[model samples]
Target: MTTPNNTEHANIAVITGASSGLGEQFYETIAHRYPDLDEIWLIARRKERLEALAERYPNIRARVRALAFDLSAASSYDELSSMLAEEQPVVRVLINNAGFEREGLLRDMAPKDILAMIELNVMGMTMVNRVFLPYMRAGSFEVITGSVSSFAPIPWQTVYSASKAYTRFLARALHEEERKRGVNVLLMSPGNMNTEMNVQGTSTGKLGHLPYLDLKRETARTLMMAERGHATYTPMLFYKLYRLFAKLMPSALAVKVTSIENGDTHGR
Candidate 1:
C-alpha cells in the first residue's frame, strides 16, 4: 500500500474487473487517455491474469499495481480500504465494472449464482464507490457500467437487468450529487458485446442475433463522454431507440417485449 518510490502522494485510476472484457479495455485505454495518472490499480479475482496484463503492457507511463480482489467477498473491501488509508492516493478515476450475469429462469438458476450476481453487481459496486469516493477530488471521473437491459426487466436475465437498473439509478443520482463537488459520474449503458463473459458466437436467441457492439470503440467513447461530464452514455442507435421505447411503453408491455426479443418466451 505504500506509495511507489516513497512518494507522499500518487494520483491514480482504479479499475475493478480488470482481468478481461470491458474492464480490461478500460485499463488499456486509460493510461493514454489520462496521462497525468501516476499509477493504475487493477483489481480482479485472478492474480495471475492481473499480473500477466500488467506485464503485457510494459510501455505504459503510469505504474501498474495488479491487486487481485474478489469484490463479492467483504474482506476484499476491507483490504482495499486499508490500502487506501495507507497510501491515501488522489483517485483520478474509478471504474466500477466488476459484474456478471446468469442468463436463465429465476427459479432454475442456482441459489448461489443469483446471490453472487446481486452481491457483485449490486452490493460490490456500491461498496467500491463508497470506499473510493472520499479519495476522488474535483475533476475526477467515476464511471459505472450499466446495461441496456436495465431499461426494462428481461425474463431470462432477470437478476442482471434488475441489478443494472439499480446501477443506472444510483449513477444518475450520484452524478447530480457529485457534480456539486466537481466530480463527474457517468452511467455507461451498452448493449451486448462479444466479451469473455458474454460470447455471442454460440447463440440461438433473438438477443444473440442483435448486432454486437465494438468494444474498443465503445470503451473509448465512454471515456470521452465521461470527460465531457455526461451523466449517461448508451452506445449504438439501436439501444438508444430501445431506451426510448422502454420509457414510452407500459411497464408490463415493455417487459413482455423484452422477454419475446430475448427468446425467453418460446411462444408461451
Candidate 2:
C-alpha cells in the first residue's frame, strides 16, 4: 500500500571519511545506487574537501549534505544524533569508513596518532553504529571499512592491525545479530589501496610503492558485495588470496612476511 513518493520512502546514506580516497569514491559512486535516498550525509573533519566532493558531483547537489565531523572526537556523535533526530531521515546506508593509521613500530609512533587510530577505527566506528543502529530496519545496510591487516596481527603496525581486527569481528558479529532484524552488516577489507592510510607518508621509511588496488574499482566492488548481504568482503583476487594465506598460515610467519613488506626489517 506504500507508494514510491510516500513520506516513508525517504531515506539517506551516511558516509564517513568522505574527504578523499575510498571514502570520496563512495560519496560519488554509491549515491546513484540508492534510489530511495533523500540525501547523502558526507561526514569528515575537512569541510572544504566535503564541499569539493559535492561540487564534483553537481547533479546530486540537492541530495548531498556536507557535515564537518571528526570521528575521533566523541562529542561529534551527540551533535550527529541530534541532527538526525531533528531531520528524521531514515538512514538506509551507513558507512563507518573514517579511519587513520601510522605505519611503524609501536614504541616509535606518536602517542596521539596511536590513540586516534583506536578512537576512530574501533571506538568511533562502534559509536557511529550505536547512534544509527536503532534506525537500521529491514533493508538497511551497514558497511564498515576494514583492511587486509585485519586478518591477523602484523609486527610493525601492531595497533592499527589490532584495531581493524576488532572492526572485522564487530562487523561479522553484527551481521549475525542483525540478520533476524533484516538489517545487513558487512566489512569490506581491501589490501594496499594506495590511499593515504595505506602509504602512510613519504617521510616514513615505508615502501615507495606496493601493489595497490584501484580506488573506484574497489569501492564499486564493496558496494556490490554489501548489496548482496555479504557479511565480510575481501575484494581483488590478490587480496582474497592474501587473506586466505594469512588465515591459513601461522601467525608468527604471517607477521614476519608482513614486516618485510612494510619495509620494517627490524621488527619491534
Candidate 3:
C-alpha cells in the first residue's frame, strides 16, 4: 500500500481500443512521458491503424504490440489471457477505453446490437480486469472510462448510458476491493468529446459548438491524473454542473428534460 510516485513507479500501460480517439491520445501521452515504459500493448479491431501509431515511436516500437480482436466476441477474454501469459508482460496500468454507440430509437435498434454493447462494455472489461490484475506489480493501477451520462438516465443513448453506468459503479467497487492489494482503480467520467463515437451532425455532437466536449489532450491529461490515483475525475466543468443538476432533479422530470434536450422519444 505505498503511494504511487510517477517518476519512480513507471511500468507498462495496456490500453484497449488504442487505434483512435481518446485511446489513441492516451497511447501517445504515455509513450512520450514513459519512454522506457516496459511495454504498451494496444488492443483493438484495427491492427493496421494501431501499427501506424506504434511506428511513430521508434524507441518503443519494439515494445508496442498490437492485438486485433473483436472484444465483443464470446471467447475474447480467454484468448487475451493466453496472449498475455505468452508475452508475460508486466502490465502495471490498464486502460479500459474501448467503446462504441449505436444511435437510433431503441425499438429500431437490432437486438444483436444491444447484446454486443453489453458484451463489450460490461463483460469484456470485467474479463480483462480479471486476467491482468493478478499479473500487475505492487504499484499497479487501472482506469475505466465511464461518461457524464453515467450520472443520469439519458434517452436515445439508452444502451450507451447504461453501459457507462455499469463501468462507473464497477470501477468504484473494484477500487475498494483492490486497495489492500496495492492496486489503484480510477473512473474517468468524461463529457461529450470530439470523437468518432459521437457521430458528426448528431445531437450529442462533440461540444466544439457548445461549451463542453473535452479535447483529446485535456481528457488524456485528466485521465493520467486519475491513473496517478484520484478515485473519480470528471474532465470538464460544465459536466460537473450537469451532473449536479441531474442529481437534484426528480427522476421523471430529469429524464423528460434530457429527452427533450437530446431530442429523444419523450420530446416527440
Which number leads on lDDT? Answer: 1
Tens-place lDDT per residue, model 3, 1-268, is: 1222224332568889788877887787777766667678888889899888878788663378787878878577778777666556666778888876654578888897788778888888777778777667657778888788788777776887788889888999989888877788888887655566553345443233445455656756765676576788876778788888988999788887665233422110
Put down candidate 1 lDDT per residue, 51-78, tens digits, no spaces: 9988876777789999988899988888
lDDT of each: 0.85, 0.78, 0.72
User: Against the hidden reference, what TM-scores do the models get?
Assistant: 0.93, 0.88, 0.85
What lDDT does candidate 3 reach at residue 217?
Answer: 66
Q: What is the lDDT for 221 in model 3?
A: 72
Candidate 3: lDDT of 175?
Answer: 90
In model 2, where do residues sit more than 4 Å from their true spots? 1-9, 196-209, 260-268
- How does residue 183 of candidate 1 score in lDDT? 97
